[model samples]
Target chain A: MQMLRKLSAGLLLLAVASFASTPAAEAAGQTLEIVKKRGHLKCGVSQGLPGFSTPDNRGNWTGIDVDFCKAVAAAIFNDADKVKFTPLSAKERFTAIQSGEVDIIARNTTWSMHRDTALGVDFPVVNYYDGQGFMVRADLGVRSARDLDGATLCTNQGTTTELNAADYFRSNGMQYEIVAFEKADESVAAYNSGRCDAYTTDHSALYAQKLKLSDPKAHIVLPEVISKEPLGPLVRQGDAAWNDLVRWTHYATVAAEEFGVTSKNISEMKSSSNPSIRRLMGQDGSFGDNLGLSKQWAVHIIRAVGNYGEIFERNVGVKTPLGIKRGVNALWTKGGLQYAPPIR
Target chain B: MQVLVLAAVLGAMAWLVGNVQSNLERQNINSGFGFLSERAGFGINQTLIAYTEDDSFGRVLAVGLLNTLLVSALGIFFATLLGFSLGVARLSRNWLISKIAMVYIEIFRNVPLLLQIMFWYFGVLRNLPSPRQAVSIGDAIFMSNRGFVVLWLEASAGAFWYGLAALGLVIGGIWLRRRAANAQITTGQATRVWRPLLGLAVALFGGAALMAGVPFALDVPHLKGFNFRGGLTVIPEFVALLLALSLYTAAFIAEIVRAGINSVSKGQREASAALGLPESVALRLVVIPQALRVIIPPLTSQYLNLTKNSSLAVAIAYPDIVSVLAGTTLSQVGQALEIIFITMMIYLSLSLLTSWAMNRYNQRMAFVGNNT
Candidate 1:
């Protein structure tokens, strides 16, 4: 008994000591300096959501969210390939960021008040303007979400889409059942196997997941967009410098699209007389210095990922399998919500 | 020395908690159980009690707890029944029966429980036909990918009086049983107890039904817009989780039981036979009762394992405590510390309760010594 007591006490002290050291390590907020020294940006993304972050056959990732991480990498290291992707589930994404497992979460997470305030993470920019929508079988004849009364819907758990569906059903005085799964693939499989009447998620995700269905052409996305889902990248709160770096990297892409700067023509447009272009290209001011980056940061971003429009059109545009239109994701000048502060 | 050790442990715990609180405050994340009252604006697939999107997070946890208990209870009941049968069958003299039991025990015990759950869920249950072309039985029960729906009874106002009448008949039957036992002991008369009790129960129930008009209406299930509208809808998740948990735990339980029976001395069986007791009676009244002393201890562990293993219900989305409270609610609330601590405490309490109940039974079956 004496030996057992001594051993247990020793074990307790060791556990307490180890746990005491972790909070101090996690409390260090110099994420940018750590990323710089580590030589790579650790990015958390969805396990497999097409047009957001899905791995290709060659193990290379291709999506709008993937490009955003690459854009941040390009701004910091001038090399977009200096990023390691950690695929995470919906329930694991925020914890991954808070636990310092990843520098940023570009997993197409919605920017909600509760998440922004309580999750200890900050949504720096809205990379994609999405909304919760439903997709049902074409033979079901459900043309709109309003017609989905008494329907059983399948969705990914721990997502804003689940809460949005609940609110929509309740406010509309409709009776419905929701079957939520941990992984996106499981929810989609459940929906495809006819366990649910419809599958609901962000509109872009619905279009992306539809292609994975056994008979894609048999499904129809409803016209109703129920809740606004401003999807974006997340960084740990209290790291203002890292937050600014990520926020500006996304704005640089939007500004590049507004200035008609393509990766192919970036070299020729460097000497252009446009002041905004000059400043964005790092030829005019100390804009990058304030963000703790090099002067050619935006140039590296443009050259690496070729602006917001290029990334979108390449990954999920009209020519791609997702074929999502640049509706609200288009620039403000083009009657959309994509706006950026002046580089000066 | 023990008090000094306890003080050191408590000091370490206090310091650790203080460190966590400081870290949470620094990160600006609120930490408390106060969020339990917040509106859970989410939907659960299966709930034993009434739940809605407007309910509080506390209500969601309650619903999840009830679901976990429901599956664990049903799993324990079925596993015990199947395990005892398999245990006896494994000791059977017949070659085919014993081999079949051996093969079953070997196969189920070797595989991981999570994979078995997924196999039953995705491979078997999800492959059922859709609601549009549901396989129906008698136009009242429906089997679809949505679930297995069976006609259920809805009680009316007359159910109360009929229930009281049945309760009175049960009490009267118990009284008659005591009187019959007294007569057997004192007068050596073998009075028939069961036949009269059964006859009285039937007559009383029949009269109650005649006056109360059966007190129940059958609620039939029919295809609605998306799925079945009525009846007792047993979701596929529950069935798959229950089936996998029961079968997997029953395999280990069968082994424990068989070993227990084998441990009984051969003299005990032979001695009963020498007294001219029939083989079945000797096994039940003598051998089996002694075997239980060996069985109860390890069998308690199997029960606890099944209860804890029910957490794998998260894999198949059964809306058990782990799936709804720990998986979904923890993600939404982001209170990993508080939620995980509570979940651990729940599982610990459940295991301890199971151990306590089994210990009580073991005490009752323990051999009592009499010294003269």
Candidate 2:
């Protein structure tokens, strides 16, 4: 009995001591420095979302969100090759970031008020401003989300779109039942199987799903924008410098677009007398130093992937086969919300 | 020396983790269980226990744990009953009877559980017609893509009074059995087991209704515009999870049951027959008692595995522990360490408790067999 008591006491003491030291350990910041020494930025992304993040036949990742991941790598190491992308599911996305398994999440996740205030993570700057919409067979004659009042909605699990749906239904005084699937693939399959009345998700994703249908022209996304879904990259709570470096990597692309810079002409513009261009490229100033990076960090980003317009136009926008227009994602100067802070 | 070596290794691991934590903290990234107390701002796909998006991580974990228990218990109860019955049928001497049982086991046992769960959840259950085209069993009961909602009787206060009176009669019957059993030993008067069995059944239900002054009331389900009103509703996710688990585990149980029966000696059956026992009574009162000793241990483990595999509820977003705490709440609060550790501990406790209870029951069964 005494021996058992002693053993249990030892275990209890170990548990309590470990529990007691957590905050003290968290107060010190050595892991971020450890990551810097490791050289590669670990970014978690989706496995397959077509234009956002998907693996090619060669196993190399290529998409708009993927390019942003490499851009952060360039901002940090002046080499876009230093990023390692981790493919995560909707269910695994949060835990991967929360457990420090991945340093940052570039999955097309929405920034909700509850997630921001409660999730111990921060989503800064909307990379893609999407809205919740419904996609249905064109023959169904569904022209609006409001028409989905009594329609069965097929949606993926563990998403803000689920709650946004409930709010939309309640406020509109519409009655509809949800048919939720854990994976997006299952929802798509069920929708195709004629199990649901319509599929609901972000407008961009609805377009993607529509294109994957047996006959792409047979389906159309309804015109109603029900909720504001600002999809962006997220970093863990704390670590201001790393967050700024990541957040600015996204901003640098927009800033580059605004300066009329393209990857094709950036090399020649290095000697241009444009003051904002000089500051952005870090050719004339200490903007890079403030972010704890190299003077040519922006230049390296442009060389490896080009500006935001090149990245989007090559993958998801009108230039590519997805054929999505640059509606709300255009540069602020072009009358949209893609605004970047002035480096001055 | 080995103990000291292991302790040294454990200490080194702790030191390494501590070093990494301090380094991460200096870079201003928070760590540890502080995140668990934060609010869970996301909604789950299906929740059995009540919850809101605003509920704390602790409450969410509780909901997940409840869902895990609900499904696993139901799976174990049904699988064991079906498995043991089929297992006996497999060992039957009749050619046609045994052949059918062999085919049933082979077909179900060979398929992977995950494929079955996916097949039921996505392919089969989702194919059901919409609520608007609900399939009613009779005019009084309704079933459809919405779900089956049937009429149920609710016991009221006056129903309890009559129930207790019936229970008292059952107790009187059981008392008569004890007296008769003692008389059978002393004066050679046999007592019927059915008398006490029937009495116990009457006591349980009658006592509930009669002593509590509860009356019986019927609750009839009604269908409204798009859904059923005033009846218990089971979701497709739950139906799929239950069907897949029960079918997967039952095939294994049947084999264990067959093995237990085969392990029994022919001498036992012959001895019972020589004592003038009928075939049905020889198999039940003689053969099964001995076979139970062989059947129980592996049967218990199968039940435990079924329980643990229910954690795959995460795959279907069944609001089980893995999906709610490890999947949703962990992301909501970033409390990865605390939530996962607590979940593992709970599962470990559940399995251990089950094993302990099974061990106790097996001991009692074994002791009785040995004496016989």
TM-score of each: 0.95, 0.82
Tens digits of lDDT, candidate 1, B167-221: 9888988899899989989999979888888888888888888888879988988
| All candidates: interface RMSD | 1.7, 6.9
Instruction: For candidate 2, write residues A1-344 as lDDT tens digits.
Output: 65665566567557756755654443333334645788888899986777888788888898888998888887777788888999987767876765577778988999887666555567876889889988887877677777766666778776777767767886797767666566787778767765567888888888776766767787787888889999999877666776787788888888888888888998888988999999988889888888777888888888788999888888798766588898899988888889999878
TM-score of 1: 0.95
Docking class of 1: medium
Instruction: Give the local distance difference test score of model 2.
Output: 0.76
Candidate 2 on B75-162: residue-level lDDT in tens? 9988888887788889888999889889989988898888888888777876677666677777456666544567677666576566
Model 1 lDDT tens row, A1-344: 99889899989989888977774575577888888999999999999889989999999998999999999999999999999999999988888887788999999999988888997889999999999999999999888899999999999888888888989998999889888898999999989988899999999999999999999999999999998999999988888888899999999999999999989899998999999999999999998999889999999999999988999999999999999999998899999999999889
| Fnat for each predicted structure, in order | 0.69, 0.18
Which candidate's TM-score is highest? 1
In angstroms, how far off is A258's CA in candidate 1? Answer: 1.0
Estimate how well candidate 1 is docked, as a DockQ score. 0.66
